[model samples]
Target: MTASYDAISPARQAISSARRVVVKIGSSALTSLERGIHSASLDSLADAVEARMRAGSDVVVVSSGAIGAGLAPLGLTRRPKDLATKQAAASVGQLALAHAWGTSFARYGRTVGQVLLSADDFARREHHRNAQRTLERLRSLGAVAVVNENDTVATEEIRFGDNDRLAALVAHLVGADALLLLSDVDGLYDGDPRKGDANLIPEVRSRADLEGVIAGTGGVLGTGGMASKLSAARLAADAGVPVLLAAASAADEALGSGRVGTAFAARPVRLSARKFWVRHAADARGSLRLDAGAVRAVARRSSLLAAGITSIHGRFYGGDVVSLVGPDDDVVARGVVEYDSTELTGMLGRSTHELPDDLRRPVVHADDLVVV
Candidate 1:
């Protein structure tokens, strides 16, 4: 069925049956000023999470606000522009964010565990697998995993653009059944919520319907606007995880009332975690320009053959990440190179059947490739 805000019953049903869920709370929802945490919001969130736990669902919270919480006490009015300052704020704010969750959850006799992630952690296979295992262990131990980006050490290039994307990836990594994206806005609006004509977009079954509903840069907290949330929704949905976008204040009601927010329906079949990482998270170090036939083959989910490669650029070692560029020179996917740059050049355009037995294998296996 075509998903739309008006027809969110399917997504609602998913939420109702979801056993494991990942909730992403934006910085605006978690803190009021740079100096202190939002106690009311924190308490309300803990209550919602506790209720979910009571229902026997495993809950993980991916939160943002370390920098926001750290800002005011440091005497800053707005988010700092410099990377060092931002990192400093995050270091301080992270403690406060965790403390708030711990203190609030404690009242309900729940334990909270802190998980800090960086972009690299999700990119590499080993680290990603380890993270998933650790989170699973934490849940089994009856502790709520409260995750946030490792902002203190993150440079500009390594930083997650926003927590929304990080949360979406986390959902995939942990095999979450649903993702809840909490923000200041109640739900997605057709126009800017500040504008009277803006109407709430209740469901989004297709990306085409989201053409003009991009969020404005008007939210009270956090740099990510509606566009980022939409990206997050799309990410989660594509991974076979449904998503709910709603107001943080309404979190409890949304989780309990069974009738609020914008729900993005998920695809029926889910991609494997490794493939998701290859398709959505891995950074490419070089580009492999391919012939038209190679493009078609890759599009059909075939392994990239060395014979189809026409050109290569940038230096990459064996196992280094690279992009598969189509005939039109657009990146179609990413994969790890089986051969180094120099070796690939010698093997390029040589059909696998004609190559020596030692070189006959596919350059990149389908299992290791991710289409963009």
Candidate 2:
């Protein structure tokens, strides 16, 4: 039986109807000093993308190869350990990588736009909106966007671990219907593929099924591992975006001739963009101490009632972000506060019936809440 988009394996079916698609190419797939730009892979990928564009699809490429490609030219033997050296290599390599992509796509008369991003840019609300607008405009102009991490400036604390998560976030930001993660391996296996009796999963229905599955360590030249790819799949699935984990060398087979790898299914209902960011992107500024009653309400998917609020922590003004902590002190959700910290302190633990008429409403409404 063929799997439906919401069933066991749906990525193939999802791609057929996907209006906007995001393809993430790992570092291993795009670079090589001895073999430069992987000609067979590039040609296959370009051909698939060109065909998709001609069929009225919007395709965006999230690639990771700047530092990897630049390593040979800089006389470095391996990936750098220090941030400064890594940044220098990325800065030099980004130019060469962009040139190669431009030349490769030129054959199809396609224009490519380079967009380098840092995690901080997407953390703030205003900047996130602006980034979204810019990418949308580029797509509307019929140009392909080649996105990469701004490794030239990223510090350890500020850097996204790998492009996998970035690709998932990009898929959500651009409202992509599907995401394809192309790497050296074909897809997720039941165990290490080299082990005896190991099997191809072919489909993933839930996280529960992934238990005991030994994911492969990533290639030495690349930053992402199988675990990180699975993490990205979880994010995309939650956002209602199907994902495909396939081989870069098999781009044509995966995209056109037939399914060539594992596919992650999309969730049925997607979170709103703002709430999605609040749940997945925004780092909480502070936490609100909730009483037992508040915990129960939140567990039931209810809003934070003013009477159930016990105390507030940290300095935050009205409309600032805060986490909702249960009586156990674990954060259950994040939301924008309607009042400042000082105002909340005065109203905390007060019954709505006993409060002044103006303070009878919720401290944090359900609309503003994002369950983490």
Candidate 3:
């Protein structure tokens, strides 16, 4: 079904039955200028989470607001524009943010564990696997995992763009059944909410639901806007995780399944964690340029043969992530290369029959590839 906004979608039903969930709170929802962090919001959130946990659902919180919380302590009136300043703010704010969350949850007898992550942590397979173990262990120990991006150490190029995307990836990492994105806005509006004449959309079954729907910019203190939240929702849905986009004030109702926000249905099938990592997290070490026939072949889910490659760029080892570029220089796909750049250099444009037995294998197997 299309995103009619009122349908009883499978994803909405999935939200009510989700045994494990990831709730992402935006910076605007958690902090303000008068108070670095909102204590009442934290208390309300803890209550909702506690209720969910009591109902057999374990919760992971991916939150933003470190920079916002730090603004008060650093005497900054607004978010800093410089990288060093933002990092400095994050270092200070993260500690304060964690402390507030711990204290807030502690009142309800809940133990909160802070997990700070960088893009590198999710990009590297070993680190990603380790992170999974850590979060699982935390849940097993009966602690709530509160995660945030490692903003202090992140540079412009390495940043996750916004916590919205980070939260979506975290949902995939923890095998979450549902993802709830909390923002200042109540739900996605058909028109600009600020300008009126808008209607709240209640459901999205696919990316087509977002067509002609323009999203607004973020708040003064937050980095992610409605656009980013929509992107996060789409990402999580693509990974077979349903999503709920709602306002932070309606946390209790949203958690209680009051049908007050937009629900995005998950796909029938999704990429495995390892494949998700390769597609969304891995940093490509090199690119393999393919000819027209090879592009068409790869599009048909065929394994990439060495005869398809015209040339290579950059240094990469076996099992490393590589981009499959078309003749037009567009990246057609990404995959785990079977051979090193050096090993593949000599086999370019040569058929499997013409190559040595050791090099006769497909350059990249279909299982390791994902079409973009």
Candidate 4:
């Protein structure tokens, strides 16, 4: 199940035969305290990516090093803990990072298209489509898309580790065949890699493999820990995209040979992008508490009717995303509701035949629903 360059397994074959791939470079892997942006590593990575593209893989790179790069320039030796300082550093570092990527890729006579995104880009339908088109356009023109988070304009919330999750979203957005996550560490370990007894996990075939694994925190220079990488890997893998988690230093070996990292095999049943969005992207405004029968119906991909619902939680308008919760209080599915919570308050536990004509419609349609 490991993605070795020389391996011939399904996961390895998928990586080797992938036509479109998303490569994510973490901040700790791309920058350092003493040198700021790691030029040698960046140059080498650009070379590896160029070689990969020439080998017929369309590459999209999601990079995180802006804050790390900005630290040295601002005379800061460590990553700033505060949001304002982090944003200020990113404002300065993004320019240097974009320039570095442009220069490195230029050596191969390839142009780099800088794309800075926020969470909204993937959550909103219009923004997602526009970003998708932009990335596709860049790839069509033989330009490498250097995608990063737009931390400069962020206010109220600042999550430095979100780039890892963004990379997963990008993979599904572009219908990528594989996702390569390059960070500071080479691969996942059963325990802390800093310990002598910890063992490298070569493959993750299912959730069972990660049952007791502790996902450590982010590194000194970057925010995404092994847990974040694992979470991102699962997102792509569950959606039928193969994933490889490796170190930036091993970019050549990992990209070219498909060796030197843990491989997450793509699920046999691929989740459609729309369903994937519903499962992972759609924000639930409200919830419907369903009976056991409704849970079974939802799991079977049936339309959620009012008769099976016990109660509604929260206030949301019609057509908003709502969570379908079972009697156990666990969300069983998520979908667009057909009626407002206020309107549905009276409709609970009533069959369509018992309700008035105007209020007899299904609460949520099957097509808009996805079982969790």
Candidate 5:
């Protein structure tokens, strides 16, 4: 039977009927404020996931706790500020975190495969395809792919910054039907829930629904906050994958009952896989500033031409992703550049007919472009 991807399923149906799901557990959900990994919580999450798998749904977990889990072991009182310290903590904690997950899942006779990824894993086309294949293979072998960012090696510039966003991207990579963001908070609220007057938002149909919501940062042990989760939801929604945000404690209900959490409906129109990857997965190496006419042409879905190029911002090679900027300094589109920055620098402002055959090609082909 063919699957539907045109519109988001209703909130209850989205979760209850998902054939494949990506569940992200935040640091606060996996670790304690005072010490190391919270064994009970991890075990409960494993049980919940096992229940989903038993019901015939493929599951992938994007868990964040390496750094937080490593804190007490390393004798640190708070999250490290420097990159090296963070990397060290990640290296120390990843083993413990993976072991805990493996042990927890084993109780239900389920196997788990650890898949650590760096930004380049998704940014580059070849790596992205390989990661997808790996995940598929793991699923086929009846093992849950427990994914996490390769924080040990990722620099700040290349980091996803939070696993919430990473989980959303993983959902797209695996063609998941829905994404569940399991964090400390039960759901998004109109104001700070701690203030006693905020009301829980049951659903977010669009960006406008989040107008007056105030999102704060994660607790002492984590990096992301409510805003990051919302952004992640929006990204997944754009790819036609609905998202649910709820407390980690509600994992069972969120996956089975679907009565708890804030559901973000998927966008009515889904981007093509290639365009989705270009827009959300690939990282921009540089930017190309376009003239007014060129901007108009791009808006009309035309291939970018050298004649429209006004300036280049950074060094980039052909096949690398770059941003297309308009006079207003807003990024209008993103795509794989057909020529290197050096080559385009010398060819800018010249009409296609005026340049050599090789240089006459569109600066960025329409097939490879995605309007932001």
Candidate 6:
């Protein structure tokens, strides 16, 4: 007879057995226009997280609601369009948001630590490590790290835009085994959930599973929609972390039972730490268009040489991350540029033997390059 243990899929088992998890709650799930931050929803979330903690699992929460919570209190009926007004609202709402989270978690004898982050935190290696250390320290002290975008100071270009992607990045940074995205929608669907014919998708094994699905944006009070959630799911999945997407109302069931949402199975292959940082963490400062030969060489894991560079786009200096673009304009890889754009302009299409001793090095060293 065949040995029998549990019939649960590995993805489902991952959810139930996750030791450290990242739970991301969206604006719509945590707040309302009329009442501002919803205490009941937060309380329920705290209950679930505390239960996990009691079971010796560590939990991190990436929450969105600062602007939404600030809207009603600041006399704004709708989300502000102007950057200044949005920032002002976030400044006011973040305090209330943090207070609500702290109070809710306190009910279960748990403490919460608020962490505000910007895109720069993840884009820069030193900053990323610092943020990771802070979060790890907080968890070591048995406190839930409640994270949000530093919206009051973040510019449009540097903003995370939504917490979904931030949560996925955090999952990777902290080495989380699972990520739970709690939103207003229960799960991904074959079509728009607003339509009656749509059916909830219980599992997503790969990107191919979402071929015909239509994901819509969030409501008036939120920034992300189902599309962002799916993107976040795929991001975490690529990092070998399983993800569960479910409605906030089903927090307990989704986290504990692992039976109420769409579970995305993680990719089997694991990326190197350096490659993961290069692919997911570093921000590209510029792009280098490569010749056909250069593209072929890069595909074979070779260093990028000035002789293969056809053109460069944008201005960047040495030590900055840059995209390696193919002749067809697709980004084939990314790496830390070894030469400034202006310096590279003088050296392009010239072989290393023809260059001065100091300029003979690869444009991007093989150790720094990561295939996309």
lDDT of 6 by residue, 79-125 (tens): 98899999999999999999999999878777889999999999998
lDDT (10s digit) by residue, model 2, range 228-257: 898898899889998888888877666653
Model 6 TM-score, 2 decimals: 0.94
Report the C-alpha lDDT of model 4 over 1-372, residue by residue, as the tens digit. 232445456886788679999999999878888789989888999999998989988999999999899999999988888888989999989999999999999998989999998876666778888998999999889899999988887654433256788899889999999999998888988887777778888888999999779997787887778878989999999899999999888899778878778889999988887788878876688899999998999999999999999988899999788999998888899998999889999999988999999987789989999987
Give a tens-digit lDDT track for model 1, residues 1-372: 112434448887797568999989988888866446788888898899889779878999998888889988788888878889988988889998899899999998889999999998887778888899999999999999999999998777887789999999999988899898988877877876666767787777888768866565535458787889988899999999998888888888667644678888898899887678777777777889999999989888899999899999998888877999987778997887888898888898998888888888788888788777
How do all models score by TM-score? 0.94, 0.90, 0.96, 0.94, 0.94, 0.94
Task: Assess each prediction's global lDDT (C-alpha) against the native.
Answer: 0.84, 0.81, 0.89, 0.87, 0.89, 0.89
Runs of candidate 1 with Cα error greater than 4 angstroms are 1-8, 217-220
Show model 3 residue runs off by greater than 4 Å.
1-7
Error of 1 at 31 (Å): 1.3
Q: Write the per-residue lDDT of candidate 5 for residues 223-260, one digit (tens) a residue.
A: 89998998899899989998999999999988887777
Off by over 4 Å in 2: 1-11, 33-40, 214-217, 310-313, 354-361
Candidate 3: lDDT of 244? 94
Q: TM-score winner among the candidates? A: 3
Q: What would you estimate as the lDDT of candidate 4?
A: 0.87
Kindly state the number of residue pairs that clash in model 3.
Answer: 0
Worst 10 residues of 3 by lDDT: 1-10
Report the C-alpha lDDT of model 3 over 310-342, residue by residue, as the tens digit.
Answer: 999999999999999999999999999999999
Worst 10 residues of 4 by lDDT: 1-10
